[model samples]
Target: MQVFVFDWTAYSENVDKFRENGKMIRLGKKHFNAKTAVDTYKNHAEAWQELERYGFDGVAINEHHGTPFGLGNSPNLMAAALSQLTERIKILVYANLLPIHEPLRLAEEIAMLDCMTGGRFICGVGRGAPREYKIFNVPMSESRGRFNEAFEVMRRAWTEDSFSFDGEFYKFDDVSIWPRPVQEPYPPIWVPLTGSKESIEWAAAHDAAITPGVFPGPMREDTIRYFAECQARYGRKVDPNKISIMVDCYVADSKEQAVDEYGSHLMYLFNTLLRYDQVWQEDVKKKGYYSSTAFEHLRNGAKGTLAEDDTVFNEWSMDTVRAAAENMPLGTADEIVERIIAECDDAGANNVLLVCNRGDIPHDMYLNQIRRIGEEVLPRLQAHNVTFVPHAQFEQAAS
Candidate 1:
């Protein structure tokens, strides 16, 4: 039951500027303001401080490229900023897009952050969104191979004093990186996967933690179960703590108040800021980018615009969204606690990543929501023994 907070610190204000045009790379220079960009980071730091104060086990930042959905073009940079600003809680980047990065440089930066933070970093990695491939100009067809190779290289780089590696995308000779991570072997490597069998198998073989990113409760449970099946096939035992699930959440004095204050922001987040429309599918398919089994499942019954597929936007009713949210723990503090317990029990997941801010939710209101959860919900959850355990501990023992 170790709980963490996640936010993209998105440039939500710029939604109107790019939503219609559907051009992400162009949106940066034409629409982004330097001051506003700086402010976004500053604001994220400020909000993270509040999360730290609320006693979250960790604060998770996500990476997104060429999109107004998030400003964390470099989640490592955000992790660096948070390293200096907070203490005690882990700083998770969920995650860095491994395919698009130079592996050696990325590995060194992560090592530096881990050492500098005194082992408060959790390295979360992924293949990344389809649009990210188009934006970064990385071949989507090679994404899984690239991610696998990059991860293998980084692991060797972090653990070996001096290493040489030759891989399809990255190569090095007798290279020794300075500032080895403080964590033994390395800090936890969390692989947040949707539906790639290769990715799931890789994570299981490495004993890395796995999470069902942004999937709903039932889907998340199914994914975790699938991961366990993979682990068993590989002769590995599944640890529930390594199976985390994400939920969009807020807590208030009453269910009604929670909905009234948080409903619109949640709706705006799903419908506009986080919308995955037909454009993404067309581009990824056209370019042969890494395909997601999860996305395919989501698109199964779609007739038009995969966007119209079971999204809150397609439902187009607060009642619909609220019903779904309620199932995932979005209501009063008591209700949230109960829902979270039930959801975790069903999924056999011990870690929960909660998203509290999105789509112009006022900073003050978000802080208040955090305060309420911290004071009311968290204390109750303590009975469940929600604690943070590094994935390295599990991997080290298995090794």
Candidate 2:
């Protein structure tokens, strides 16, 4: 399968030293230094170049606003920087949250990036985090509708010379984006498929690529299968290479080494960084912001957890960490290769997104881990019928 690195650019330099006692992660800015944030941008660019040198098909970035969990408040900014840095690897912005953006502006920005990268950009779209919607003063209830409408505008803007749109969320009269994307039929659109059936169906209907994110157990595999099912209904071919599976990954000399170094950092992130702002959650609940299916899935995922607990540090245990790492390729090089292949075989996943660093892991450790995976795991993966097909090729095939 084609391999990608999902860089969170997590600001993990001094979190333990600065966090307020009993407060959740990303809650405050006591530890967040402006200088460090600037330094992180440099680090991310350097790391991406190293990943490209080590042989990754692409590097994916995501947007997270008002949180130190990810500094990519605007992933397009990172994409712009990387476009100048790297020449070969694909730049997958696994979504620019549509609800938070002006679609026409986003369309031109992406088109500019596509041209800058010589057609190496793959656009990924999503509804965004509920917390971000609140932070941006957007009503979460309109997320899906806004996302659908924005995507249509973006697509037409990329393809048409001059187009007018009248939609519920956006209206444009005879507007055209300059410097259309280099890729024919515009750069391919990928969707980050969480637990949204509607999103999965929509992606398939539009012949967009699907990247299934980390969910509880069989749900990830089930989601990929569901994508195939949706494609069948739409009479579209299911492309394994475009079906990406994202997982939390760390590898070292031994399983113990990997666990001891990365395990607690990972646990800290899931426990602290991933904890939705309680106020935001409550507001969403009061407003019924989530779709019924999305809400049900969230409820199911939080069952018996300390989602409501005040003691944030005590929220997770080794049991939970190990359970979460079960499906992940988290051991040595050999172990990682084995698990990855088996997973791709089971889920029909031909693309993988590896989150190589999180929390307070050292930069050297992250680079070393990526080096080993590249030297050992990637060569083996290449033998397994995995190759990236260009977005333009897919467009040509359809035409």
Candidate 3:
């Protein structure tokens, strides 16, 4: 049982408000505009270092947007910073958009980071955000195909010693990448999907992993069943223990305090992400997939409502968010830890990723959340044998 904290860095500064009137909680920094390198660097600095010092086996980051909100688009830079900041802790980058970049370049960057970290890197690649593809002017029709090609290209760039590739998307006369990654055969690749059975089957066939985030939702049972079925279809036995999930969490010294500080943020998360059928229209639904439904249900359920319409409702009140946050796991450290432990226990989770700041939380408060999780939650988790063995397993093999 590994407990990995995750933060979406969602800036609450995005949209205005809804009918319910609660601000639409965001998952990425409000980068509809642009952010100066100086400003972004100054903000995420402490959070990065604290994760390294904390009890986490590894520190993780994902490329969300470009420049501002999804600014970590170039994770090698982020990894480089992490290399200088911490002595240990695996640097897990959910990945450089495999489809959008030159595979050889990605390979080189990954290898360079691995060497810099003394081989402490776990790389995961995706087709880049579908929305981002539009922003980057990438052809969405070819996103999946391009991703598969780049995935192979990046690997060959690291492993083939010397090779050539002439694929539909990537064409290289010499598939040679300088400075190979330290991990043999390359780091593990986990495909993040929205409970797509095809995805599970594909991952199983390649011995890859999937983070179906739709886990632990209202359709939780169905989601698990689908994954199991996919594993079987792939003829590769998958230990439920190997599957991981992403759940929103928060903690405090007292339940009241937890509610006070985390209430609005939590509610905002549900409504924005799980907007109860609000985004189920074919267009909005097609954008992200059925998992969009998951958000709708989760948000609706949390607010004790039924999502019967598809009017793309955004109406919410701050009061609603405040109340939802109150009932959630926000509580004293002891109480919060208890809840986290219970989640891991029930799910038999091997790894846990925590999404820390969803709303535009004050930077200081975000750092405090990390520190609290590290000091109070981590020790008890390990003592109770709850956290899994490796949030990251990027240590260099014994020579």
Candidate 4:
């Protein structure tokens, strides 16, 4: 099993100062503090470097814009820095938003990172959050088409000597990129999904690995099952190594201790930061970002937000935190290991992405958590191997 830590790289200091009313205000230059932003990047980079020393296989970063939720507006830039800062740990952009980017340039940049890191880069692509669409002034309805065309352009740019693309969203002629990717054909492409059937099928068709995103256990299993079926339709077999699960984890002396320390940050994540520049799911659906059945299995007959139900957000409290912690991998190292392994086993996933930092926990505390995960959780997880894909097995049995 490969273990990766996902960092949000949020603006860490004085988080409460950014809030207006009860909600987080859209952060702009006024909210920006140069020292705070610098420290945030420096601390996260230091933490990422520590992952290499602590024996983590990779460190994952993501992109967001115009919010304090994640300062990683250009995850590619972060990955480039990581290539220089760390020696061995894979730097996963986990994803670059394809729809909003010029694909040829993205291709060249990723190739540069791949060459810089000597093929230790994983290219994760996605259509991005609804808020990002708004920031870029892109039509949410055209996200799928743009994402597909962008990926095709990048793919061609990476593999072909000279390629031309004339697509609805992008047009290029006689494009041959310098600094070709170190990996043959291209670097591994991974997609982080929110249980969208269309996204799953698209990933399967492209033979990209997928992380089922953060969701409850049942929904995650359904995603894997559907993905396996999709892979089979494309004449491919399910590979455990190609499936990854993202889980919010914390390691402490006991479950109670873990919850007591990490619960507030978790709550803040859900109640405040995540809601910054929030776009409601109903609006997203109306905009055609999601098909009618995209999230049918997970929806509870209520219009939810992109990641969770509106009720969950509205009803968030300490009780909600404790309840959520029950399912999360939070507890002693042994307990966390057990839960993570069980989740991976049940979902037929061999890779795990641990989200241990969020909601602007103190820098030292964040480092402590990473150190503990490295010393305690990492070894156990690294030792465990997932050998079979349950989804594929189930499909065979049904057939």
Candidate 5:
């Protein structure tokens, strides 16, 4: 099993000041303190360096724009810095928004990072969040078209000697990149799934790895099953090594102690930061950002309000957090190990991305959790191996 830490890189200072009427003021740049931002990045960089010392296999970062939710607006830049900062740990850009980027430029940037890291970079791409589309002034309806074309352009740029592409959103003539990727064809491509069937099919068609986004148990299982089915359609077998699960975790003396120490930070993430762009989801849905049946499998018999209303936001509370933690790996080290093993066993996923820092957790507290998990929980996870994928087996048996 491969264990990676997913750092949110949230801006923690004066969080309340950036909110108005219970909603985050997206234009609150006046409140931004230069020193605070600089120190935050410095602290996070130091923490990432410590991951190497703590025995973690890799560190994952992501991209977001014009929001305090994540400070990594340019994850590629951070990945470049990580290349020089650490020697052994893999750097995963848990993704770049494909639709908004110039495909060839991104291809070159990723290639450079791959070479800089000695082929340790994992190239993750996504259609991106609705807010990002708005940030880049891209029409939501054109997202899939742009993403498809951009990905092809990048793929061709990496593999072909000199290629010309004439697509709906991108065009090039006899272009060749200077530094090809160190990885044979290209660095591994991984997509973060948000229950979109289209995204799953696209990933499967490309034979790219996937990390089923954080969701409830049943939903996550359904996602894996659906992804397995899609893989089979492309005549590929499910590979557990390519399937990863993301989980928010905290470790302490007991479940109570863990909650006491980490509950507030977790709540701040859910109750505040996560909801900053909640309203945009509906607008994006109207503009065709999400498929009409995006989360259909997860809906079960309930009304399809998953896309219509942000129910997750309405239901978040400290009590809900504590109850959810029961099923999560947020307890003592022994309990965390047991729960994480069970989770991997249930999903048949071999890679786990643990998120210990969210909601602007204090730097010292974040480092402490990382050290604790690295010392007590990581070794056990690394030793345990998952041999089969249940979803793939079910799909094969049905076939």
Candidate 6:
């Protein structure tokens, strides 16, 4: 079984006494008054190194925003840092938001990282959240279209010596990019998901890896069912290694303590995170993302928040917030393993990615969970062969 580790590297200095003020917490090294990401990097450096030490085959990173909610919107830059810190473990940026920046430069940056990492890079891309689009002055509606084109352009820019393209969103003539990606044809493209039908279909057509957030909750089952249904309807068979499910995890001696301790962080995720769901703003439409199937306008980013509807957040609505938090298993190692395995089987998923330190899980809790997972749960999962293998490190045995 292949296993991957995911961390938002959530920042905060308090270390104890949970509180978020109904806003995104300033939880990272940089945002929580730490001098820089390098400082926050120190906190996780050992943990990530531990993931590698404990036999996780791949390590994944993601972007988030707002003080206490997220400070790292440039996960790719950090991915480069990880390449130096980790060895043998596959490195992935669960995504680099495509529409927010120039695709060509992004492509080159990824390519450069690939070469530097000796081809250990697993490139994930996406149209990203509407709030981000609003923040960057990019239209939400146009993001998907631009995303599709930008992906194509990146592929070309990475593989071909010279290429050009003309699309509604991006146009380039005489496009010659240097430092082609080390992985022949291109590195694996992990399609970060937002649980949209359109997004699923796109991943299927391209045979890209799919990674979606399954915030611990009652909705976990629904999240699994939806994705499995989409893949099946489209005749897409996701190789377990290529498909991943994300979990906001914190391990505790008992479930109640887990919930009580982690509740505040969960609240922040629910409230502040809701703000990002909206597909608000006239610019998003003007850019060709004019119509969106996304459950947009669930929060405040002020591009014209859409009235709440059932279609967007689905089972993850306001009422279910408590249930969702309740669903995240914060118990003994065995219990967590059982819950994770059951959830994976029910949802037809095999990969379990835990974003540690999220919700400000305590350092001791983090250490215990990591070791427990490594010492107990992981071997069992491997024995069952029920999950993706954390990319294994191989060396030539003496012949």
* lDDT values for all models: 0.72, 0.75, 0.60, 0.85, 0.85, 0.63
lDDT of 4 by residue, 306-345 (tens): 4444643564688987887888788999889999999888
Show where candidate 6 strays beyond 4 Å.
14-32, 36-38, 65-67, 212-236, 271-326, 362-364, 387-399
Give per-residue lDDT, candidate 1, residue 350.
Answer: 83
The digit string of per-residue lDDT tens for model 5 on 102-200 reads: 999999999999999999999999988777887789999899999999999999999999999999889999999979999989999999877777887
Task: Pull out the clashing pairs in model 5.
Answer: none
The runs of at least 3 residues in candidate 1 whose Cα sits more than 4 Å from the true structure, single-residue gaps closed, are 12-14, 17-30, 216-218, 276-279, 290-319, 386-399
Give stretches of model 3 more than 4 Å off: 10-37, 66-68, 218-220, 230-236, 266-281, 284-316, 322-327, 384-399
Q: Worst 10-residue stretch by lDDT in candidate 2?
A: 302-311
Better of 1 and 4 by TM-score: 4
Q: What TM-scores do the predictions have? A: 0.86, 0.88, 0.77, 0.95, 0.95, 0.76
lDDT of 3 at 254: 74
Any runs in candidate 2 off by more than 4 Å, and if so which?
Answer: 25-31, 276-283, 293-314, 322-327, 386-399
Model 6 lDDT vs. the true structure? 0.63
lDDT of 3 by residue, 1-399 (tens): 566666444543433343234444432444343454455555776687777778676666787653223446667788898788878777778757776787888888888888889878878776554556656777655666777788778877878889898989888896567788788888767666553344445566666656654444434433344455545655544453465566666767776676678766654555554352222334533444223333332323312112223222344466765565554556677776676666655454556677677655667888888898888877776565533312111111110
Candidate 6 structure quality by residue, lDDT tens digits, 1-399: 556777777664433333356433433443345454455667676777888889876788877654444546788778787788877778888788888878999999998889878999989887765667766887565777888898889988977778889999899998888788889888898876544556656776677876643332323333333445445555654356665666555566776666666666665454444433344434344554534544332122112222233223332333354465456655566777777776655444566676655545555656666776777677766554444222111101110
Model 5 regions lying over 4 Å from their true place: 21-23, 293-311
What does candidate 1's lDDT look like per residue over 197-222, in tens digits?
56666787888888763554334444
lDDT of 3 at 181: 79
Clashes of 5: 0
Evaluated against the true structure, the overall lDDT of model 3 is 0.60
Q: How accurate is candidate 5 locally (lDDT)?
A: 0.85
Clash statistics: count for each candidate: 1, 0, 25, 0, 0, 24
In candidate 2, what are the lDDT values of residues 1-399, reduced to their tens digit? Answer: 688888888875645554467565554655568888877788778889998898789999999987667888889989999999999999999889999899999999999999999999999998886777778898877888898999999999988889999999999999988989999899988887766667777888899888764532445545555666667677665777777777667777877777777888887676666663534444555654555565233334433222223323346677766765666678788888888776666555688888878865667887887788789887787678744323323333544
